[model samples]
Target: MIAVNGRDTEWREGLTIRIIMQENKYTSPRIVIKVNGHVVRQEQWESYAVQDGDDVLVLHLIAGG
Candidate 1:
């Protein structure tokens, strides 16, 4: 199992940052993702693997004018 935004989720064999984002419906382009407290770059999302029991945090930045 993996923890995403403090919620438990089933761990998958081929789980990646991109997959997690899609699963959680994080469609915002201005967002940051962290795995185990480490930031995952946008370009590395596809290659960044999410392991079992990992803690993932997705935060979107909102702008106000």
Candidate 2:
């Protein structure tokens, strides 16, 4: 199982942060992603593998006046 946005989901094999973002229709890297309380570096997104029971957090940034 994987926790995404506070929701637990079934774990899918061969999953990566980039793939997750793509699957979720997130096209920008401006947002931050934290896995298991640790921030995942942008460069490592493709290499950062996600497994069962992993907690993934996707935080979107907004700029306002």
Candidate 3:
């Protein structure tokens, strides 16, 4: 199991940041993802693996006029 955005989620082998985004339906253009307090680069999202008991934080950046 893993903690995503303070919510418990099922853990799976070979799970990457990209997969997590898809699973949670996170499609914000300004979203930022960090695992264990380290930032995950956009290019590495597909390769950055998320392990069990990890704390994943997804921050959504917003702008207004």
Candidate 4:
């Protein structure tokens, strides 16, 4: 299993960052994602694989000043 936003989530084989967002319905225009304490670039999300026992942090950004 993997930890997403501090909550335990099921870990599945062939899981990617893109899948995680879709599963959680995270579609914020601006956001950040961190895996295992390392930042995962937006361009790499589609191919970035998430493994079991991994810590994933998805933060939705609020923009407008």
Candidate 5:
């Protein structure tokens, strides 16, 4: 199991950042993903693999005037 935005989510092998986002229906264009306290590069989302018991934080960036 893994903690995604404070909620417990099922963990599986070969799970990448992209897969996690897809599974959680996270489609925000300006999304920031952090795993185990480490920031994951946007370009690496498709290939960044998260492990079991990992804490994943997904935040949507907002811009205001």
Candidate 6:
């Protein structure tokens, strides 16, 4: 199982950060992603693998003038 934004979800095997972003319809690299309390780099998304019981946090980027 994987926890996303405080909700538990079934583990999706072979799910990479990239795939997760795609599944969630997020294409912007500006979004922040944290897996198991660690920030995942943009280039590492394709290689960062998510496992069962992992906590994934997806945060949107906020900008201000």
What are the lDDT scores of the predictions, listed in order?
0.91, 0.89, 0.92, 0.93, 0.91, 0.86
Question: What RMSD does model 3 have?
Answer: 1.1
Clashing pairs for model 6 are none
Candidate 1 regions with alpha-carbon error over 4 angstroms = none
Q: What is the per-residue lDDT of model 6 for residues 1-65, given as tens digits with 9 covering 90 to 100? A: 89888987778788898888887798876788999889988889898889989999999887886
lDDT of candidate 3 at residue 24, scale 0 to 100:
87
Query: What is the RMSD of candidate 2?
Result: 1.2
- What lDDT tens digits, residue by residue, belong to model 2 across residues 1-65? 89889887777889999988988898875899999999998899999999888999999988886
Query: Per-residue lDDT tens digits of candidate 4, residues 15-64?
Result: 99999999899887598999999999999999999999999988888777
Q: How does model 5 score by TM-score?
A: 0.92
TM-score of each: 0.93, 0.88, 0.92, 0.93, 0.92, 0.86
Candidate 1 per-residue lDDT, tens place, 1-60, comes to: 999899999998999999988888888889899999999989999989899999998888
Runs in model 2 lying further than 4 Å from the true structure: none
- Report residue 40 deviation for candidate 3 (angstroms): 0.6
For model 5, residues 1-65, the per-residue Cα lDDT tens digits are 99999999999999999999888898887998889889998899998888999999998989986
lDDT of 4 at 31: 83
